[model samples]
Target: MKKLNVTEIQEKPEGFVASVKEELNVELARTLKAGNRMLVDSDGLAFIYIIEDELDYYYVSFGKGTWPSLKKLLANQGSLDLELGNSLNIELTAIADELAFLTENIEGNSNYGEEMEKAVSDIFL
Candidate 1:
């Protein structure tokens, strides 16, 4: 498949992100970083890229920011009653449901439009 030049992806990414992904999976799979840099994010979005290898590969990621609310709710579970706990539970379930969308590898690429849209929007902004 044809790939988007790194400069286009880095600079003028204004089209639908799925389209961009169709054109840039090879680039992203090779160029994106692999972990959260909470420390570096004050300066910008801490992009973490990871390239796939045999026996170890992944596509999408939900970093600390994505699950912190659920983590906090679970950590403070003792302080919540049924009503509050139900609400927190709902939020936690949602976070888990959202995270469950991540695939083990490129097997899920065709369905990554939602995530790609969010990531590309964040990066291009």
Candidate 2:
């Protein structure tokens, strides 16, 4: 189960690489991050990235409204609601292999122990 990279995900017809240019008027080719999970349904192409512990990010494009780093879908936030959009229909977690790899790689590289130790040492000073 090889983890899918951003380029592969963008190549799909459901992807918004073109839509992003047409809709949002932004070029995303250079800035798009590797997706941890992706899903394509009738609604649109939706993808997710594990930004950090307990912090996840998402983007969905219906050939129209397209945005990234959305905390929650808002009318003004992007153009659709997470619950109402393709996310609900497309389970990102179903990509277990990618999810597992993403979590392990992202979390494994975190310097939580070092940061915590530094915080503790600074607390008494």
Candidate 3:
């Protein structure tokens, strides 16, 4: 799947939402809720636990100070669904890129690792 530019995402909400649901095995309601949470907050750190939880199902390994790194990995993986490919009208690419960078460049204690792990487990339960 080709990586979408941010503009393509903003212009087509239905398509974007649909693709995310299909690829992530997430319902539209859940995706929308998560997306809204991401949008309302500028810091990706707030979403670390959520993202970590989601990734657990895929068996991806994440390390301390690796939240940003994981975002980059997801962005690189990109979307394979056709609906999302067509809905590329928003600035989501840049937003995604920024989030990836933030995640990759973050410097701090690794205490959040356990917290994120627990949060992921709880959410999945």
TM-score for all predictions? 0.17, 0.22, 0.24
Per-residue C-alpha lDDT of model 2 across residues 1-125, encoded as one tens digit per residue: 21222322122333212212222212322233334453332223333433111233435332212222221222122222122122222223323354234334334333434443333223311
The C-alpha local distance difference test score for the whole of candidate 3 amounts to 0.29
- Once fitted onto the true fold, the runs of candidate 2 whose alpha carbons sit more than 4 angstroms away are 1-82, 85-88, 110-125
Candidate-wise lDDT, in order: 0.26, 0.28, 0.29
Candidate 1's displacement at residue 9, Å, is 29
Poorest 10 consecutive residues by lDDT, candidate 3:
1-10
lDDT of 2: 0.28
Q: Report the lDDT tens digits of candidate 3 across residue range 1-125.
A: 11111111211323222122233333421332122112111222233212222323111112323333334345554421223233431112333454444444333324445454443333322
Q: Judged by lDDT, which candidate is best?
A: 3
- lDDT for residue 7 in candidate 2, whole number 0-100: 25
Task: Indicate which candidate wins on TM-score.
Answer: 3
Give the C-alpha lDDT of model 1.
Answer: 0.26
Which candidate do you rate higher for TM-score, 1 or 2?
A: 2
Structural RMSD, model 3: 13.0
Q: What is the lDDT of residue 113 in candidate 1?
A: 52
